[model samples]
Target: MTQQPTNESRLERGKRALAEIDGEAGHNVVAALADIAPDFATYLFEFPFGDIYCRPGLDLRSREISTIAALTAMGNASPQLKVHIEAGLNVGLTREEITEIIMQMAVYAGFPAALNGLFAAKEVFARRG
Candidate 1:
């Protein structure tokens, strides 16, 4: 985990990162968790956004690319994949780049996963358009 300013709490840093990266979609995910698992929402922000994502090693675009690929490979996280697909675009990934990333997954993640990812990308792209 990268060091955070002593003044900024993990939740604060996470919220900032989430807003910068995921925008409304990220906030919606956190808000949706409020009634059932508010703590999970906190964890989501603090851990993934605050700790891991806030690291300096990779830029936001690269991080989004990795996230999209991993989610696509899982083949069971279409909803999350959709969110990251949008995030990928938000961070400057062109549709062509996104398609290529998913297509590359077919070799390691199988045709079904790649197809599912492509479809999810299609849905996100359509929504954006």
Candidate 2:
């Protein structure tokens, strides 16, 4: 987990990381891209999960927090936001922690974005129940 094995390809490393972080939801996102942009799925796996997420500087929980914050700020990435919110939970983020993180975004991302993020969180939470 510390380093990508020398023998593994980026795709392999990414797939492993994606499974660890996003689980089924991550696989679904990649699968959905199969018909339209298969290469994009490879890119998504390689760059974010493989290259960035595997870095040891931040733990998975911290990474998910950052991701949740960024997606919430974007305000238009509800689908991505929901996926990451679930990912956040997968990586040990509590519902309270997730709610607080989105609420804090209101200062910078505005109330609308925060509200949207909260609603997305609500949906994910409801589904998990």
Number of the top TM-score candidate:
2
After superposing candidate 1 on the true structure, give the runs of residues whose Cα lies further than 4 Å from its correct spot: 1-6
List model 2 lDDT by residue over 46-120, tens digit each: 999988998888999999999999999999999999999999999899999999999999999999999999999
What is candidate 2's TM-score against the reference?
0.96
Q: Which ten residues in a row have the lowest lDDT in candidate 2?
A: 1-10
Off by over 4 Å in 2: 1-3
Tens digits of lDDT, candidate 1, 1-129: 235687988899898888888889899999999999999999998999988899888999999989999998998999999989988888889999999999999999999999999999999999999
- In order, the Cα lDDT scores of the candidates are 0.91, 0.94
- Top model number, lDDT: 2
Worst 10 residues of 1 by lDDT: 1-10
Q: Alpha-carbon error at 36 in model 2, in Å?
A: 0.9
- C-alpha lDDT (0 to 100) for residue 129 of candidate 1: 96
